[model samples]
Target chain A: MIGGKGISIWFFIGSLLLLYGIIITIANVVEMVSPSVDKQPVLHELNFGVWWGILLLIIGSVYFFSFRPWKKK
Target chain B: MLGNLKPLLTPLMASSSSLLSLGWVDSLIIIIYFAFVLGIGYYLLRFTKTGEDFFMAGRDMTMWIAGLSFVAANLGSLELMGWAASAYQYGILATHWYWIGAIPAMLFLGIIMMPFYYISKTHSVPGYLKLRFGEGASMLSATSFGFMTVFMSGINMYSMAIVMKVVLGWDIHFSIWVSSITVLVYVVLGGLLSAIFNEVLQFMLIWLGALMIPIIGLIETGGWSGMVARIQQNFPGGDYTHLWRTMGSFQDNPMGIHWTGIVFGLGAIISFAYWTTDFLVVQRVLTAKDLRSAKMAPIIGAGFKMMVPFIVILPGLLGLAVVMPKLVPENMVSAANPHSYNEVLPLMLARYAGPGLLGLGVTALIAGFMSGMAGNVSAFATVWTYDIYRPIHVKLTKKEESDSYYVKIGRWCTVLGVLVSIGTAYMVQQFASIMDYVQALFSFFLAPLFGTVILGMLWKRATKAGGFWGLFAGMFSSVGMWAWVKLDPSALKIIALSEYAKDMAENMYRGLWCFLIVVIVTVVVSLFTEPKPEKELVGLVRGCTELPSEGHLPIWRRPIFWASIVLTVFIVLNILFW
Candidate 1:
């Protein structure tokens, strides 16, 4: 809704990021429990996916809620 | 000490082919990205009813949207991967392109040059030339700009396809066709608006996708100081860590460049010309909602532009510190040496990213490549329709055509441009690296165009004949110098002014020489030719134009205020890194 109305670009960005975050976070959680055979990087023990996913979810949620097209109306 | 740690780092490089495969989660992320972009275009289709809407995004983009898209359009994955590769090959010297090579010119465009472009109501850069310099200059620039832009789109397209092939083991032909068609569908549907929206999204994806490398990389290396220490121990006697200390002599640094070339050729001429004159980026700012937004767009872009090196350059530096069996140049790449310099970004992503993150990284790159191609094709469509086709049509018909007719032509031209780009993508496969190829193309067209443009906008004496001939002479001389070096490799010493100057230095010096040629020729020709009436030159030239003031806005609201802040930070970063 940046230029007078329609679905805001931020909403699109947030929705996609939120969706990807949920998927990534859940997948990483399951992987942490099962410890799959897939080769991991040097700091894989740090579980970067879970934290990075959480970060995306937080940022995306802020954007999505703040600029939600319905809210603008 | 660093040499002793090589064995431990080898396992972390993720050199095995099996590790590159994307799981279902990764595939889902990429699919989602594609769906959203296409949906954006479809949603915007109704808003794009007129020619102005198609070519200019209805001239309603906010500074935030326009500014982000401005930088994002130029931040194609080709450049991301290429510059990261450059950082590895040339060390911190590659950061110059992001900093001095871009920031100063962007600020100049925002604070000084943006007024003329905004106030004149021109549709494209070539449209501005047409207003000031008449048809000869406009046609020449429009043709060349259209040509190079399409070729660039093809290069971007091919580069992405090749990266997909190399990194994910995806089929190159399938990658090229799929990506090109997706871009085509969207651009044809919603035009520049679609491209700008996608570019904004791509900018975010690029950050989210690539930011992990620098973050996790610093963690592994302990920190910036630790990474610097490791690099020093690994490449002892190599001037890789210091930004300016090794810039004194051509032989002192890995890039084999002198400070004069970096300052005069790169920072002064090439960077200024590209940022100020290149329509692909300028068109973004041109879509700003108002005069203030137009002026503010590039300045905002410059701020974000400063941080780009983190994602592009740091990965290359990280690769150097940890990657085993040193990456070789393209010519040296084979079964025995599978890693080339250009593969640095993808290699680093594979090394650090697991299943879900891997998809995001790949999606980011795909977004970069598609947005780049879309930007070029969209720009090409506008220039081709407005500058080239419309002029010819009016000449034949002795009247203007309908807006819908022109819009129809723009859509068709987009399709044709994409087709031509696909052909050019195949042509690019024969080249070793397209970075130098693209740089050479920029020098030929943009460097000279900047000369004609800056003079036209500044000096009232610059006549139509002067602008046309100046542009002709500059382009001819650039191509002539390129041929001179090609026919006799020793001529590089004369052209670049040093035997130690490499391909990168050669590009900068060439841009500098061409710019000088255009200025000298324009000045000489204008002095002999009759000048245009000052009244007629209003809005097109500086002195004759009555520029609109920003009014009594607060100091924080002024463009100059932000520009100064950006400039101060720029100076500080150069000093800190130096």
Candidate 2:
């Protein structure tokens, strides 16, 4: 009973969610694998900064583009 | 006798200057904000002419207002205060709530679930269930949802009141009265329109306040790197190094991410159920002009959800590093108690943020609290008027009289809902973790409803008997799990229990076991029961399609579906290992 347009939209959204989930999951894996010293991990901020920037970019683009509501008419 | 007397005398002995001398600036800001909210509510009263107008804003809400209110309602003062408190106490694992749970659930709810819901053309989530499943399922869902709405609203009020009391050293009753009166007046006067307009203003303030802290804090700390270094210097460990690392045992390490099972398993399930099935959120989407706008609401909200860790969680982590070190050991003891997590952000704002920014921060907290209250009040009014009252008052069938009566009743319901929530807030001091308490309370109702709605939509075999039984099973199992956890602490050890699991069990209500048990029982029981009439299933599915000729999945979207599956698998593996 799902429509072609509805399916297409769901597919696009599902992909984006999955991609974002993977990126976050990978970031967690890198955090787990990275070596730790007695008290601190070297280059923690630099590492976090890189991933944080990437996430912000992706999320920001999505926010800007979402304003165009897809009308059924 | 002396030990007992100290508890009674503590309030009288405490300094009153901090409460009374909240300077002209803070007093002025609060007064202006209060007046503006009341003014808007009174102005919007003109629009509440009919039931639709009062309950759903005449179903003419645009994407921007609906989207903004949806996010604002979900991000209450408790969220910011709770996040800061958790980050202050537990390491960064709290951020997973945003990254792993809320974002995905929001998107799925918007894109997948909302279209189906909008097509159903029902006013509330439970109303949709009544159409899809049967009356019994709808009533059960409504009762459960009602309990959750009132209890969580109470928690939200309590958290906001406590934050204000902590910041200004005001009396707890004073904080409660101010929040309750302001929220009750607007919701009573304007219904949903007033709620929405005020929510728009509240949303802006919350964003302004939440963002202001990190900006001002970063400047004071010399920038992001300096702030990072400051935190590192204070709370030394690998736990603080990355956002993903756990803090070992939960008991010894108060900040440890011990509820991984709950987070990934039950947390994911119930969050999806909530965003997809709960009426407070679904009501906003249902009010959308079209299916596309309805879908856009949550997707837009998800984008904002991604920013929460930065605005709410990170600042809290930084606040603890910056402010807690300066406090006396006795003050630290009172601040770090598990029950007092809601006080962390407000304490940080009062201690560190400069004067001009402090007004804005406090305004944001109030706005967040009010928006959540407004959403619940509006939704409660809608359900009571449309589902409960109108059905019972069948003698008045004339269109004009019916519409007039419904609107009047909706307003009354709004007032009653607000009053009850305020009363409920008085009891919030009893709960340990506000977040877990709200979530567990919600799961009791949400899981069963989710089972019924999803099955009713996808499977024609789901009958009223099965739907009702599944609902009972789901609610019972979930509540049983929570009650068992409360009564028998040792029982949790059977589930490959981590040491942190034991700690979280003592403090927080675990609902994952209940959610899974409900879903399973709902499905299994539905299979054994008779199929619903084909006409019922067909009618529910009709709204989900575009046109008679166009198919469900166009050929063009096939590759995207495959790619998504691969990506989901990849994420699953990463989370499992990481």
Q: List, for all models, the DockQ compared with the true complex.
A: 0.69, 0.02
Once fitted onto the true fold, the runs of candidate 2 whose alpha carbons sit more than 4 angstroms away are: A1-73, B1-21, B247-263, B324-342, B392-401, B427-440, B502-510, B542-578
Global lDDT of each model? 0.89, 0.62
Minimal lDDT window, size 10, model 2 chain B: B17-26
lDDT of 1: 0.89
lDDT tens string, model 1, B1-578?
43564553332222236326776677777878888899988888988989989999999999999999999999988889999999999898899999999999999999888999988999999999999999999999999999889987887788787777777777778788888999999999999999998999899999999999999999999999989988888788776666788989898888888999999999999998999999999999999999899999999999999999999999999988987778899899887768889888888988888768988998888988988899999999999999999999999999998999999999999999999999988988876476466647666888999999999999999999999999999999999999899899999999999878898899889999999999999999999999889988998899998877767889899999999999999999999989
Cα misplacement distance, residue B423 of candidate 1 (Å): 1.4
Superposition error at B1 for model 2 (Å): 52
lDDT of 2 by residue, B504-547 (tens): 44223344555556567767777777766665565464333452
Q: Scoring only the second chain, what is candidate 1's TM-score?
A: 0.95
TM-score of chain B of each: 0.95, 0.83
Candidate 2 docking category?
incorrect
